[model samples]
Target: MTLKSPISIYDAQGLAFGILMASLGVTFLKAAALVTGQTAGAAVLLSYLLPLDFGVFFVLISLPFFWLSWVRRSASFTLRTITAVVGISVVSPLLGAFIRFETLPPFLAAILAGACSGVGLIALFRHGASAGGLGILALIVEERTGFRTGWFQMCFDAVIFALALLVLPLDGVLYSCIGAMVLNAIIGWNFRVAQAMPAQQVG
Candidate 1:
């Protein structure tokens, strides 16, 4: 399906929903002591070891990618991605405070996080934004060559998970891999753009 050129008001709402879901997913992963990949994983890892906030780390990690977004993509795309990153960074901790999971099982947390991240990423992709880090790189690669962003992300995730083995328990690594796969699978299956259509027409 082809989306309109200029972003619609409905898509703006979708952007908000996508950010919210993605933030919630990150929060769940953090609570479960699991890490996915990319900026989110880095932020979670930092928040674990340092006296830093995940929101701050999330936004900080994403800052460097804006340069790539602006140079390879467009100002509008860069701005939108910045907005998405900021929104997720700010909202995640707020959600964490109130949405307490008293006894969230690791498996359940992994599934919930995966589903949220997958659906949220699809929404962001449809609206021409992403959560930054490998997301920005994936989007750019997908735009330049008709490659799938999800697969790109999965490759990056593999590296992240490999490093994660040093810090995370085997069970946590297993669940993280599962969540990562779920996230990329949703994008690969649903967020594909046709060869004839423009990359922006990805709704």
Candidate 2:
């Protein structure tokens, strides 16, 4: 098969918006003392347990996924994925400075965080990039089996949350479960819509 076209400058620009939205969502999650799944979720867990920065943990966790992207996708794709991961790491921490929440209800934070990050992730996927970790595997599985990437991501998130239940309080894990469902649902719904439509239109 021929190689897919490299992402254009426009799509790269689009990834920035995606990264920003995803970062903002994570910011909310952190503020509410919630943990998610995927690379972002892992970062949240580590940030809670360690003195490390969330962004730093995010980028560090993403490193292993680069090999998967390179082997399954393309060099261009791997590069863009790297950029997206780094962008998220850098922006997530900075977002706290500009946006402060005095008291965000856990349920509200979960839903809103999920929605925002889900939209951001969709944008990254469409542009041939991801936030790394299970996201890379999700894309690969989706491309092969026509499975929903969101479902694959959700499965990964489930495992993370199962572990999270051990580390986080009951309420936090409960809210996280809700947020994970919302996040994956958005991605699954939108991905189905994209598949049903023409590529040009989806873009």
Assess each prediction's global lDDT (C-alpha) against the native.
Answer: 0.81, 0.83
Q: By TM-score, how accurate is candidate 2?
A: 0.90
lDDT of 2 by residue, 32-60 (tens): 99988898898899999999989899888
Model 1 alpha-carbon miss at residue 147, Å: 2.0
For model 1, what is the alpha-carbon lDDT of residue 94?
A: 87
- CA lDDT, candidate 1, residue 15: 88
> On residues 1-203, what C-alpha lDDT tens digit does candidate 1 reach at each position?
22235667976998899999998898889889988878888888778778988889888888889888777766666777888999998988888888887798888888889889889878887776788888988877877787898888888888788888888899999998898888888888778744322454331
Off by over 4 Å in 2: 1-7, 192-203
